[model samples]
Target: MYCFTDPWYLPVDLKLIKSIFQKDFSYFNDHGMYCHPKDNISMNLFNLVNEDWKNLRAKLTPLFSSSKLKSMFQIFVDKAEVLEEVIGSYSSRNEPLNIEDVASRFTIDVITSCGFGIETNALKNSNKEFMKCGVETFNPRLLKFVLMEVVPSGILANLGFKANGAHTNNLFNNLISEVIQYRETNKVFRNDFLQLLLELKQNQEMTDDQIIAQCFGFFAAGFETTSITVMFAMLELALNQEIQNKLRDKIEEVLEKYDGNVCYDAVMEMNYLDKVLNETLRKYPPGPIIPRNCTKTYRVPETDVIIEKGTRVIIPIWGLHRDPEFYPDPEQFNPENFNAENKANRPDMAFIPFGEGPRMCIGLRFGLLETKLALIKLLKNFKYTLNGRTKVPIEIDPEAIFTLKIKEDVWLDVTKI
Candidate 1:
């Protein structure tokens, strides 16, 4: 496929996709996205290529380990409780809730608290600066996206073009600097991502700009992707009452084992919830496409076609996910599609909401834990149904460049169970 003069190889073959992501990763290691040297926030792990990505990933990997996430689990529960209160107010008034907006706020609070070690109280106060910054950061401008793709990063940097707006860059820069300064001055220590980053900085393993860029990337990636997953999961559950009820039952059953507390272990015990989340990801992956850059000339396995270095590779994740060959009745929102037997029958690469191999999303576990906690909190306490305001068949926003988003707000009628 050609976008203007730039050619992209859209590979639909699963075997080739696997090789691109894993086996032949050395040839396709970079994402090929433009990142201006002037844009510090854009130089995150997601955008960095080769050694930069590798070093940063190695340093940050420990911060998201099982013990680390368990330590952060309480943050998820606390924010989810706030989310429950916000939803309860709407349920009391018999008002339908725009779940996407509410979930976005919930995730904002969670990410801020967990990642920045600060409380933005986004759920209670929707007009917070963090909320505004998040909205602006992700606002899809088609022209900007196209220019970034077609133009070179150095040229863009020379022309004073950045990946993010001035407001976003300034807010994150100032906010992170203030927090780091305060923590150092007070000798404060917190078991959060920022604290870990500070330790890395103290050890001279990371520079100030790298730390700021990572914090920005953590917020930018963490909140929206998890919130989108929560929103879509709720939408699907509302549309499929039986699945919703069954999932709630599983949640309750698992919580019972933990004395009715929604702990890390209890959430992990809910295998059915995993299946539901997997199915939701399959149907509405946050990132519908995976982009990779060919770093070296590579010949197609068992073919004469030679993909030149610098060629862009587009792994059509959405197309493969919805293909009828892998998923019979591809349009159906059935959790059973992810059950042990069914999943075993499908190819491993067929289900990649998070891209496969090394460059896959680093925050996969954190994202899933946050998303599952939100669903458990909401479903265990309330019964939700699709409100009339939501379109019967939701439409995907054509302008959503980065993530999968519904064109219309997802409104659901909620009643306290």
Candidate 2:
């Protein structure tokens, strides 16, 4: 494909995507999205160069391990409990709840807890400064989007244009610095992502900016994706009562085996929830495109085509996910499609919600865990129905350059079950 006469490669076939993303990974080491090192908030795994991404990924890999996730389980549960209370109030009011806004608050609290190592009350105090700052950070204006995605990072930096908000960076940096100083001054140790980064700093002598940049990345990247997942999942359940009731029954039954408590183990073991999540991701992947910059000349396998270095590659996830060949009745919100039998029948790369191969989302585990927990808790107590206020055939916001979300609010009527 040609974009403004520039040779742009849009790989439609799953095999082609796998080839570019995996087989020829060496030729496409960078994401094509660059973050100037001087811009601390932008120097995350998503924007880091080849070697930098690899090393930092290895260091941060341990933070998302099962053990590490379990250690942070209470933080999620605590936040979910708050979420439950907030929802209960809405249910009592017999009013429509804005799932997008509410879900954003829920995820913001979770990400802040994990990233900042502090209990954040975004659920209670929706107008919190950090919450607002986080929203602005991800909700890039048109100019910012053009500057970051269209223009080269080097050019943008030279022009003194920052795609990332300096206000957002300062807020996050100040927050991290304050917390780190408190932890150091009090000689208090805790098991969290920040603590892990702190240890890495001590051993590797990483700059404070480096650590803060990652923490800021963790906060910025984690929140919206999970929020969108929950919003869509709930919307699907609202529209499909049978699925909702069945899922609720499964949740109740599973919680019974675990003493009626929604623990990490029980949540993880809910097979139906897993299927629903898989189906949701298939239909509404947070990131609908995977991007990479070809760093070396690479000959296409079994073909005479040669992609020159510096050529950009785009893996169109939306097209693939919606393709009827891979998913019959692609628009249907059926969790059955993700059942073991059906899943086994499909090609591995047919679903690339979190991308594929080595460059896949490192935060996938934590993100899934958070989504599952939220669904378990939300459905355990309340039921939702698509309200009149909700626009059917939800439209995607063209403004959301990087994520998939409704342009406006997702409204649903809530009732305590």
Candidate 3:
């Protein structure tokens, strides 16, 4: 077991993360993301490192650029409004709602609109198959897949370990493959993530397996993390009414400046909204720990200790974000931590939600815009408060593989402001 199980797995502060990512990147260039190149369906950008990663990244980068995301903002706005309407209807019934489920559908709608270029109406139909597929794929047991990534197969025998999960494997493979075929045959040109992959399939010599793998990557990367982020953001907003009021004030101010429309440019102008989102991400990073592998033997700069080839390097982002040195009173939800003055005083790597370097998350712009647009519409339409049923200091769902989620139902009451 290469994983550091001896400790409680805490104390991964930002400075240590900077050493692994920026200060000592040459020693830890590759993330030990899951890959089974032989399986074809198992390959994606997340699993690729070095030149292969470089090539795929180049291809996908233009797709998520600022202009591209701006072009797609309408999709986010439409889906977010749908989410607003859906949640509003529920509030009219005076029913305590599980925002976990609502947030899942909201993200799924965004994914379908921006990823597949198809409307999922997940906010409209909670039982959509796409949402179900996402639930299965991100199941906490998927960590077993990650185990195969960092540890050698021989070591597995000693641990009684197997990497694959049947449910997630089957669900992702089928869902992605079907989406690709449907797009290709229909000659759809909506210019979303899947459509881009389809164009590659037609224009490039990339195999069906590669196409499907990229689609799978889109699904995995796009859906769960953003959904969980919205969930946490809403949860925080519900608990902190003063913060919510401040955020709502900012949203209304921005919209009023743009002629009562929450346009792409208006979302861009939301400085405080951006701060709240950044603070939420800081307190509850989607993937709190980042894992990398030492591709070659290297010695620590200050110490004589030599890290062998294939050494597993873990950067605890969550621990670092909460470190008192970088972010004083890290436990408190303070948007001021991200204000221009305080932000300029902080270290470069203290805030790494989307990561840094050439391998940074490609979908970051799109992800943030989608999240912001949702919050804008949601807060503008309704005021949220933590319902009595919701547990304080909510427990993180143990079953989520790549993101933090509420294990139990998180209910919030909404009243139109």
lDDT of 2 by residue, 1-417 (tens): 875557977777677778777877888878887598666777887878878888888888888899999998998888888999999999998988999788889998898887777767879988477666656776888766655656877787777665566678678778889998898789778878888888887897466788888887787778888999999999899999999999999989889999998888898889999999999999999888777888899888888988899888888888888889989999999999998888899997888898877888889999999999888888998988999988888888876767786777889999997
User: Per-prediction TM-score, please?
Assistant: 0.98, 0.96, 0.89
lDDT of 3 by residue, 118-232 (tens): 6667788775677656755566364565566447655654554323344545655676677777766886678677767777777874666787677667777888888888888
Report the candidate with higher TM-score, 1 versus 3. Answer: 1
Put the candidates in TM-score order, highest first: 1, 2, 3
Residue pairs with clashing backbones, model 1: none
C-alpha root-mean-square deviation, each candidate = 1.2, 1.6, 3.4
Please give the lDDT score for candidate 1.
0.89
Candidate 1 lDDT over 284-319, as tens digits, reads: 998889889999999999999999999989888889
Candidate achieving higher TM-score, 1 or 2? 1
Candidate 2 regions exceeding 4 Å error are: 149-151
- Candidates in order have lDDT scores of 0.89, 0.84, 0.76
The runs of at least 3 residues in candidate 1 whose Cα sits more than 4 Å from the true structure, single-residue gaps closed, are: none
- By TM-score, the better pick of 2 and 3 is 2
Q: How far is candidate 2 from the true structure (C-alpha RMSD, Å)?
A: 1.6
Q: Rank the candidates by lDDT, best first.
A: 1, 2, 3
